[model samples]
Target: MSTPQDINVRQKPAVAATGGGTSTILATKQLTKNFGGLTAVDGVDFSVAEGEIRCLIGPNGAGKSTLLELITGQLAPSDGAIYFDGEDLTGLDTHKRIDTGISVKFQSPHVYENLTVEENLRVPLQRTDRDVDRVLAETLDRTALSEKAETGASELSHGEKQRLEIGMAVTLDPKLMLLDEPVAGMSVDETDDVADLIRSLHDDGMTFVVVEHDMEFVRRISERVTVLNQGEIFRQGPIEEIEADEDVRRIYLGENA
Candidate 1:
């Protein structure tokens, strides 16, 4: 199993950067996904610079989850291509993508309810040098769940479960992480805590593509934001820039401004 001590910090590749390093760590060229008569995701071109926190947001049924599934290989795209670390990832399976240093955390926490918090993180500890104990401790600490380490997954609150989900993802030491509505249903305090954890990971040079409906949280965590509407790319740019665009506000943000 991977342990924290086994993490080869020097061997990890640098993430693509907005101005320097690699142009983009993850990019989608006209990616599309459809379900028979329903086009869940239209041709969408998306990219995230290394070390950047890119947020994907839109109204309900805007295809945010479908786009994430496509990028993470949980679902194949009907058309276009996906590139990661300069390699085509179109046909790769989800496990293969995970092996390539990509991890994803769903909006609803997926914990083994019968297990302890420590055991929860052990599921992803199978292939890395990450110390199970260390990762467990750090993750619990990061999520303010240190006291809950021995608690059963079934005993955790909704927010604690969410934190544990994040802990599991980090144990993989992924180059990039995709989080879907991480703070959904979280209390204000829990939301702040989760945001702090995200910032901490970003500071460690981790790349992220986050989908969220919380505009306040999005503005706080994202360096860039991508807006989608009816499965199409509505707009993408710096958070402030996207927020200020009139068309984006109307079509995606639902703002009169």
Candidate 2:
């Protein structure tokens, strides 16, 4: 079996700002996804700047998840293009995209319930040639799970499991991380903890594209917000700016906005 020490990941260099002084790490042009007759994601143009946090929000069926799938290569786009690290990644496979420094953590905790926290970290780094013990220690520290390293994943609290999942993603040393509803079901304290973690990572030069519905959490961690409506981008700006728009307030935010 492969071991963590045996895995050595080769990361791509960070891309500088391009195309009209925009330093977008990931960009999509008229990106669309369809399932036969139903268009899940309409032609949408989106972009994420390097080392920035961007949140995607909308009412149900706004294509937030679908847009995420397209960017991560879980579902191929029916039209448009995907650019990552300044290269075209429109038709790349999931694994290939991952190789290009993209990692994703879905809404649910996707951990190996039977494995210990340390073992979970070991599994992903097994193919790389990095030091297994060292990486494991670092990952535990980074995710705030060092004390629980020996505990089984099934025994971890929901928030701890979420952090563990994030730890696993970071082992890949990705430049951009996609998080879908990361703080869902987390307590206020837990949400704060995750937000702190995300900010810390961003401070360390990581870029993130997050999809969340909790406006409180969005307000806590979001630098910019993108509102999706019926498979298209309705508006994108600072959280305060998005909150002030009457149409967005009436449509998605309701009385809350």
Candidate 3:
């Protein structure tokens, strides 16, 4: 794990094309996680600048999800520290992290099938100082799900469910958002729509760290990317630089070109 001082010394200023604001919002120091004898995340260090849509790309079992879980407190790291908004969060619980404006959306939609779209959103709405009705209205409008707000979660198409999950994340007005494979199984059109939604959110000043396997989608949304392999960072740089690197291509992209 690297310290803030280490990041400042080694990491160049993140490029500005992706709308990353010039302030650091989240920082990690020598973050490590282990599950019994299995070391899932090994001393990873990174910083997410304010308003940047940073993407984490890696092969399966590369520890991307584990890193997210550690940051969100779904799992505690065996060592290292996490700092968000200038406060130490390495010791906080998941809900506590949420309360501090860190929200995570899993790959699978977690909405309640029994609940209406409006009701599904109400769960997170109940946690903030923001007015629930106002947040709900904004979320519905943003996701274009107003018409389906009264529809049950189970009634939604796969795309709609994905949008709803994003809407729920939006309603929280988080300082940092972790999206895990947000368009995992959507059609091409649906993938495009979700990509647009993510771009819009970034434009609206939201910071995001997305874990995705969709290279094209990642290229569309991320200005900078971090590659993780076998639990450690393999590369970190602007998208074009990463894409053109032979090592990155061999390890993650393969001959898919």
Task: State, as a TM-score between 0 and 1, how close model 3 is to the true structure.
Answer: 0.89
Q: Among these predicted structures, which one has the highest TM-score?
A: 2
Reference-based lDDT, residue 5, model 2 = 43
Global lDDT of model 3: 0.87
lDDT of 1 by residue, 141-254 (tens): 877788888899999988889989998999898999999999999999889889999999999999999999998999889998888899998888888898889988787767
lDDT, each prediction: 0.86, 0.88, 0.87
- Stretches of candidate 1 exceeding 4 Å from the true structure: 1-21
- Each model's backbone clash number: 9, 9, 2
The TM-score of candidate 2 is: 0.90
Model 1 — TM-score against the truth? 0.89
Question: If ranked by lDDT, best first, what sequence of candidates would result?
Answer: 2, 3, 1
Local accuracy of candidate 2 as per-residue lDDT tens digits, 1-257: 64554322111211222233467888887899989998889999888888999999999999999999999899999998787885567767988888888999999999999999998988879656778888888889888999999999999999999999999988888899999999999999999999999998999999999999999999988999999999999999999999889889887977654
Model 2 deviation from native, Cα RMSD in Å: 6.7
C-alpha displacement of 78 in model 3, angstroms? 0.8
TM-scores of all predicted structures: 0.89, 0.90, 0.89
